[model samples]
Target: MPSTSISTGSAAGPAPCLAVSGASGKTGWRVVEEALGRGYRVKALLRPGSEVPEGLQGAELIRLELTDQAALERALEGTVALVIATGARPSVDLAGPLKVDALAIRQQCAACRAAGVKRVVLVSSLCSGRWFHPLNLFGLILVWKRVGERWLEASGLDWTVVRPGGLKETEDDLDAQGIRYSGPDQQESNSIPRRLVARVCLEALDAPASIGRIIEVTSAAGVEPLSLEQWLARQPQPA
Candidate 1:
């Protein structure tokens, strides 16, 4: 199996309070849980009607619409960083992706800027920008996701976009899976457990080199498991 020491040094200081939007989703709640495990205080943000997931028990939960400028800003205030795990679910509504993935992301970026949250991590997907992919059949999700990513890139905050391949819910045997990390568009297909994706998001938060980069991830048993820092060291530095 791929062997590398993963460090939590990115968050070495007194852990900063973290804000996680979409805290009710499969991936979002895990981000909250992982952050709490890493000794960070967490604020979990959800839509007004979102159900409270059990994983959010220790977090401070705030319910509000992402479009509610005032509410979003208020929830983000005092948090040092924000992780946006929100994505439009598959639905009959044809415009859901435009509203949730693109528009909502723009709103969140504005709120982050207003709230002075300097660091933001966005959980996107692999093949996000392609128009011909099968995943785009649902409200053109991949297209909108790319739109959201572009907005974050221009948002003037420290940002990292983690684009993971098909997300699996399996938690067992995760320790045996080694993450294969690459830069944007490097990998088009594969799968990773949601749990691993969560850990990578937190790891990216602590790894300064992850800023302003789009990291693609997938995993399989026996693949080399390198920390985000180690993977980053192999890439050319940003100009």
Candidate 2:
């Protein structure tokens, strides 16, 4: 590996392959499409019974549950980096948050180490480490999400945690929205387009400064969408 460091918002080449889990979800599919549009190869990891979203057809698809160690390892093989877009879908089962958010994160980190995939970007949530928040009502989801973020932070892998505010489904006028980037525990209570969140995940893969850092993001109209590199240069690194 000749110099793994990269300026933010850029990947190595036209073929810098990325493996994306939860590729069946709306956000996951968009992440795959954006990666492809940017000229990077992508391996989409879906579940055994996951419906194949149309946009993901051209990319390499790997199907397996997160608990399947052999399949997980093989799917992540040959990828330089990974973006974890998996999240517990809204469910009546209260334990879904812990199982999918925290435990699954630990499993993926282990697989990354085994497969020699050193760079990872995690899609975390706002107020993750907080004890008193509404989302936590869902089986202490905020607490568990924090656990997941901590797992990646302590895993010793090159990692970045992107904590986005409330998610939205709107795509039109997205170009008019600018991502408000901040350090961990900074901004909260605003929403960002899922497409922008996907872009930030890919951007972190190519940003050396992004590693070992927690970046909070939310978007709003009337603000200039700044590049991650430009934002990073303006802030003092966490010490």
Candidate 3:
């Protein structure tokens, strides 16, 4: 059976139908697995060349190139929300970040619009717009990521940007590692598990307060874990 039923989530309600575009990556796979564990129906979208992550074996899979708008439209059909776990995997090609990170996001937003998929949660980096950063050495990635975020900003869609700190892998005791959620640029450094990032993405879909906002997240072992609703309630609303 699919991991999470299309009826339950971290929020204690029926899970939403989630379409994840980068279901083959380490973090992407975790999001799919976590979503399943939480009772959500997942549609795993991937490029044909992307390696198949073993954990994603049971997900409903859609294979296609990002530039193929028709395929993107087809894959997103019936998806209640789109969780953009896709990113420019580190590579030798300098243009990969721009094409995949910036332009790809624009394409997905366009397809979402065409397919009536209104709610979108983008998995972005913590330092998305900064020109100076070590991660940018991999292709000026941060700059391109910001470009992608801007595209979504202008797409006229209901969107949330989950700008996470450096990604880490850990499934143990996530509830104990409280999340520090802040408005865009409120934070500059930290790390979080891919699983938590996925949960936050699902959380944002139902949070009207999250729309049009750029939320940065990081985790701390010493901090008491806080739910998205709790974090959001305490932060200023997006203007």
Candidate 4:
């Protein structure tokens, strides 16, 4: 059964800080912003040269390479959970996906274990792991994304993989856009605003039942609105 409670650290004090990797990215900054709005301290992690976007203004910024295990672990030391919003951008370098999507994830998982950050949420993509898809032309991105997901799944940490469809930049009238959630591969093509994707990443953190599951998301106007907990409640418990 899905736990109804949302953890705000221990009963004794302030909420544990949340660390969001790729904080300079479109979705990452939104996750950081949302976390802050929810009253949690946030650490926005970015690469050394990544620009500080306006969306990340209020959070503590830590700049470091994800491959630098020492630096990554240090940045995560005081954080209770890490939301991985990293993804390989389309670039001339064909190896970008392999490095950013796969190897970087392995490094983050290792860093999390070292830092004792037990909970993690990974923002992935729909059709991740599919080979024949057109998106694979770009460095076999989907394949590499699946590699990343598998790494987190086997890391022995409380983790949730949110695979959203083509991301949109528009944030207007978001309240009317209802998210359609499903198990892995159930959602193939559609689009959801990046803001909604950010919210679901945090929502997964609050829903204990989200652990060890891949939740695919897409949004449309007529779909019934449901929180992550509500959707999880309707599913059969894992045996």
All models: lDDT?
A: 0.91, 0.86, 0.84, 0.92
For every model shown, the clashing-pair count is: 2, 0, 8, 0
Q: How accurate is candidate 2 locally (lDDT)?
A: 0.86
Displacement of the residue 137 alpha carbon in candidate 4, Å:
1.2
Q: Over the stretch 88-118, how does candidate 4's per-residue lDDT look in tens digits?
A: 9899999999999999999999999999998
Residue 174 in model 3: lDDT: 83
Candidate 1: give the clashing pairs: 2-224, 10-206
lDDT (C-alpha) at residue 35 in model 2 = 85
TM-score of each: 0.94, 0.93, 0.90, 0.96
lDDT, residue 172, candidate 1 = 95
Q: How large an RMSD does model 3 have?
A: 4.7
lDDT of 4 at 210: 91
All candidates in order of lDDT, best leading: 4, 1, 2, 3
Please report the candidate that would top lDDT against the real structure: 4
Please provide, for model 1 over 76-156, each residue's C-alpha lDDT reduced to its tens digit, 9 standing for 90 to 100. 998888999999988899899999999999999999999989889999999989999998889999999999999999999
Cα lDDT of model 3 by residue, 1-239, tens digit: 11121235367655567888889987788878877776778899998988888878668988999899999998888888788889987789999899989999999999999998887889998989999888889888999999999999889888889999988888898878888888778788889888888888877765777788898999988876788877777876544
TM-score of 2: 0.93
- Residue 209 lDDT in candidate 1: 82
The TM-score between candidate 4 and the true structure equals: 0.96
